[model samples]
Target: MFAGAVRVGTIDRVGIALSGLCVVHCLTSAIMLAVLASAGGILVDHRIHAIGLVLAIVLGMVALGRGIVEHGFMMPAAIGGLGLGVMAGALTLPHDSGEVVYTIVGVAILALGHDLNRRAVV
Candidate 1:
């Protein structure tokens, strides 16, 4: 049981880190798009967002699923699910529109969910 808890904690941390990376990628890509438009092809790639969202979904679900089992709480999973939904919604928007804002907000919420899950585990 201790080992499983530790693994869950580790997964939560990874989820947080991934969320931070997603935020950084969104912000950096926006800045890069504004400054050096040539870099937009790589930085603003839609595939990157898709891949990141997939990762976020997987990590969030696994970590939060374990958290609910161990901690017997639903907030973390609910928050994380909301975040994932927001992220998925962002994908429907045009890249040049409010996508970045939605992505950042979703990532931040997801990171918060991860932090909450970690705290509950501890």
Candidate 2:
């Protein structure tokens, strides 16, 4: 997909633009999830955790909106919703299990986001 030139229409151009924003936040969430795991707990830095939590919420909402706008459904919301579940699970884990779970879920979010962005309509 990265090998060819991007021939973008106006709507596609807008989608392509938004693709970056949501995906970018997804990436940021991944990184923050990693660091938040180390220092024993994310509560240690509520600010960073707060940022990731907010980003995850935003990405989930945007993905949901895109699915509704583009396809009259909520597939993006579903995918991002899974990410939200994972993130919440990670945050709530009693111990370091959060790190392990977050990593696995983060990878899924990254892959799902990529697939959603890559697929041609229908």
Candidate 3:
């Protein structure tokens, strides 16, 4: 799906877009759950979070890994790895136990890493 973007060195941009989507999903889920009691099942599904995290990890690894290889720098990949770890940790939190906060922070960090990766490449 993102072949063209990746080939054109826009992987970081794609990662940033995914990070934005993750943030939107997190906020929307929180709002939906608060506003509609019946929205819990769909919005709070663990599978969704798991899938999102996996996507982030794969994209981060690819983009940051390539960035490090090209620029001979590891900071972007390190930061991305740390962000992925935080996001994974969020999954371990109990419901209503500040999971959203962790996820959002992780996503933000991940986006920053992608931005750094882009800069390194340039």
Candidate 4:
């Protein structure tokens, strides 16, 4: 039981870290694109965004699902699901301000869900 709890905690931490990275990536990419067009263009690759989205989805589902099962809390998982949906929707939109807005908002909400899950587990 203790070992499983530790594992879940680790997964939750990792999910939170990934969400943080997503936020940083979004903010930095936006700033860089606006400030240094050429350099920022190189930094903001579609592959990176896609990878981050995939990681966020996988990790969020795993960690949040575990939390819900263990704690019997639905809100965290629901919020995270909503956030994931928003982020996925962003992928289909134009790569302009709209996409950035959606990504940032989704990451924020997803991070909140992870935080809530951590608190509930504890």
Candidate 5:
């Protein structure tokens, strides 16, 4: 049981870190796009967003799913799901400011969910 908890904790930490990175990437990409119109686009490619979204979905599922099972709290999972949905929806929209806004909002909400999940475990 202790070992399982430790593993889950590690997963939660990684999910949290990844969520933070997603935020940083969104913000930095936006700023870069504004400053360096030509080169910045390269930095904020669709592939990068796709990769981040994939990681977020996978990690969010593992950590949040475990937390929900252990704590029996659905809020964390609900929030995380909503965040993931928003992030995924961003991909379907035009790759403009709207997409950036959605990504930022989604990542922030997802990170909050991860935080909640971590707390629930304790």
Candidate 6:
């Protein structure tokens, strides 16, 4: 019903959806990280975080795989979509003014990764 109410070809619905998704994404990421930190900091170890990073990247690629199978040779844009979300959360985590430099670097790397993924689509 809600989906049907959304008009096609109008930015109205898309903008609302994106905004809502972003709000939820931010809240969920914050809560998850907090829980991880409080519960013995599951992500504290550099080696474990490295593994998690690899897993996250793989999941993004898997999303692309699913998209490729569904679209059948169309632009597999899933990786960029996922990478953008990851970067968005990562950038906000530090919150400290001094971390702005690191956030900029993360965003730049994210853009580069997204661009590479998008370009590689066949």
lDDT top scorer: 1
lDDT of 4 by residue, 10-121 (tens): 7777877887888888888889999999988976788878888898888887888888888889999999899999988888887678889999889888888888888888
Candidate 2 residue pairs that clash = none
Per-residue lDDT for 39 in model 1? Answer: 91
Lowest lDDT 10-residue stretch of candidate 4: 1-10
Residue range 1-122, candidate 3, lDDT tens digits:
33334563588999999999998988888888888868865977999999999999999988988887777789988998889999999999965539989999999999999998888875
The regions of model 4 sitting more than 4 angstroms off are: 1-8
Highest TM-score: give the candidate number.
Answer: 1
In the range 33-118, model 6's lDDT, one tens digit per residue, is: 56665643343333443454454455445444443543344343443454445544554455432333343343344344434433
Where does candidate 3 stray beyond 4 Å? 1-8
lDDT of 2 by residue, 34-120 (tens): 676563344434455446557656644554445455555556456656766776666565434455457456536644643563353
Regions of model 1 farther than 4 Å from truth? 1-8
TM-score of 5: 0.88
Residue-level lDDT of model 1, residues 2-105, one tens digit each, is 34555658988998888888888888999999889999669888888898889889888788988898898899899989899999999999997499999888
lDDT per residue (tens digit) for residues 1-85 in model 5: 3336566567777877887887787788889889998988897788987887898898888888888788889999999999999
lDDT of 2: 0.50
**Every candidate's lDDT:** 0.86, 0.50, 0.85, 0.83, 0.84, 0.41
List the candidates ranked by TM-score, beginning with the highest.
1, 3, 5, 4, 2, 6
Number of backbone-clashing residue pairs for each candidate, in the order shown: 0, 0, 0, 0, 0, 0
